[model samples]
Target: MSTAYVLVEQNNGQLDHVTAELITAARVLGEVTAVVVGEPGTGQGLAAELGALGASVVVAAESPSVTGRLVLPEVDALHILAAHNPGPIVLSANLGGNEIAGRLAARLASGVLCDVVGINADRTADQSIFGDTIQVSAAVGGASPIYTLRAGAVAGEPVAAAGTLQTLELPAATAKDVTVVSATPAERGDRPELPQAKVVIAGGRGVGSAENFKTVLEPLADVLGAAVGATRDAVDLGYYPGEYQIGQTGVTVSPDVYIGFGISGAIQHTSGMQTAKKVIVVNNDEDAPIFDIADLGVVGDLFDVAPALLEEINKRK
Candidate 1:
């Protein structure tokens, strides 16, 4: 039987949503072998969650020095886990997990695929292209296949399982000379963050002003159950939160539908959102760069148009 390794993410022992999805994705391939790498707080429920969802084994790396701050130390134990279980490794596509996935691929001399939405029973990825307009199933090449699963892209089904939980202590990680300091998470809006949004509505300089964004842009997003995003210009002008910017320097998103409200399409901005399945642009300038990639274009005053659009959406629902 093929064995799939699912890396469980923990934040002070709280299980991440991605963990459940990874377990669900593994079910399509074969039996799951879950692994957790970090400090042993009394509350890491990832292992039990994996077990409940049919993980055949759970390997935890507990070392005095192997803190969750770095990937090299975690990669060390991961190599050992893969050797014993020997199969594709799956992880979340978040910053920390993405880094580890890349590092592990380099160390193992393996093929790595990132931001996967789905998986097949034969251990292939259901990859997307052209802004999620196409779905293609692909397998990893090289010695071993490694994949990073994106959050909110996959749905999971739970299955009961009995599994072995092994705790392995490793050599203390060499503390990176980097100084430790207090960490504080950035404050985000109650509105869904862009990465986790199903539909994203973005604004640009075309929207007119920063004040207009809340009155016109935000209400529409709320109607559609969507998150708000912005082009680089919009972010710079304080029309949208910096975290809400989508581009090369910003987060990559693959939402079901992306509605560009008055955003003049910069190639950099399009590069980030081009992965969205359906793109709709609204700009008064008919020749705005955004229209070139837009599946639907509306040339009009957004102040007049957005209210009507929100009304239409609410009526449909």
Candidate 2:
């Protein structure tokens, strides 16, 4: 059977949720191995978790330069491991993950499938293309294929493995033309992150203003413990932060439930979230394109429907 390597990502000292999903996806292709790159001791701590998700072996590489220099550090580590044991590589479809996948694929001279939503029974990667109006399956012939899977594409199930952990020695850092001089952390809040949240509640141009978002959407999001999202129009209007914008040019998410308030569901916006398992839209315009994809549509003013829904949810709680 084939062996697939799952590159695990972590944040705030815990395994990134996508790691589990990658492990699950890898098993679909073949036997699964997990590769984790982090500071000293992160791999050992994460091995058990990766194993529980069906990783037969875990390779951990320690590097202080991981977050310091861009994607080279990760590519260097993968190059070493792949040299000895080459196989299909799976990674998450995020900013950093895409960079690493691209560089690594170039080094390996392998074809890469990006933002794949599923794996075919024949191991080809399934992708949503052209604003999700088309679906395509791609296979890499005569070479190991690198795949960057969208976060939340695969539902993870724990299937225990031996959980063997091994350390990979990183090579000397290569000279770089550019340097990372400074960085600022994002604002931290109690809510789950937009990409990883199982439930996402988003506001759009109809939310009116930032104050209205705070008054209407914030409470509903708080009650449901969901991450908040915004459309490009809302973000341009300064009703929400740029990071909250969901579109082809913004964050891509595949949540279990996506609830949009006053969102018209432009193709740019739908491209980012069409994979959601259940889409519920609340918009006044009955002809809004969002309802075309929604599993449930509430054609009413969000100001009235949202508060009433929250009240009902609270009463049930």
Candidate 3:
């Protein structure tokens, strides 16, 4: 039986959604063992959830140094786990996960498949490339293949398991030349995170300015309870932070409903959000490219349309 190592990420002392997804994907290949890296005991309470999701074992590596050392310690811990269990290594396809997968593959001298959206029964990976213009299948040639899966790309299913917990020990990780002195968290907001939100409201150059975004977009979003996104043009103009930018160069999102205002629908921008289940575009120009993919298109100014829309929505409520 094959054994897969699934990297589990936790936030604010709870297991992130990606962990369950990875577990669900791993079960298709073989038995799953989750590798948790964080403050010691981070995996203790996660056993039941992980087990219920098909993770047979939870290998928790507690290290206060994980925060200070960056990705090196994670590579080391994964390296140790991979040595004992020779199979596929699965991780989220985020920035840090890509880096860690690359380094770990190099350390283990194995080939890697990245940005994987699906895994076949034979273990080959399915990936979307060329600004998501192409869907390709690839297989890594080696004893073990490392994969970085795109977040929200796969649905997680709950499977019964023993839910056993285990601890892994390694030599104290020595802080490398790169030391993180301090870290500040992003300000908290009530809106759902962009990648995970089922509904997203994005603005582009048409929103006019950052101030106007607050005046027009925020209220609509508040009424709909949607996460806010911005186009590359808007982000480059400093109307919003780079993190909120949704395009090929930024984060990819596959929400249930994506609403765009003043967005022209550049290929770079569409690549990231084309997977959304439903797209509604509000633009002044009838010839805008965004209308090509939008399920519903409005040829009017969002400033005029948004306020009325908000009022109507609130009136019904």
The prediction achieving the highest lDDT against the true structure is: 3
TM-score, per-candidate, Cα-based: 0.74, 0.91, 0.95
- Candidate 2 C-alpha lDDT tens digits along 208-230: 99999999999999999999999
Output the worst ten-in-a-row residue range by lDDT, candidate 1.
173-182
Residue 247 lDDT in model 2?
76
lDDT of each: 0.76, 0.85, 0.86
Q: So what's the TM-score on candidate 2?
A: 0.91
Model 3 local distance difference test score = 0.86
- How accurate locally is residue 155 in candidate 2, as Cα lDDT from 0 to 100? 72
Give candidate 1 regions above 4 Å deviation: 42-44, 51-54, 63-68, 114-143, 150-164, 175-179, 219-225, 236-238, 247-258, 264-281, 286-297, 307-317
Model 3, range 150-248, lDDT digits (tens) per residue? Answer: 877787787888778988874575535368889897795898888888899999998989998899998899889899999999999988889988988
Candidate 1 collision pairs: 131-274, 131-275, 265-290
Please give, for residues 22-78, the per-residue lDDT of candidate 1 as tens digits: 888877667787777767642245666668867878777775444434676567777
Q: How would the candidate models be sorted by TM-score, starting from the highest?
A: 3, 2, 1
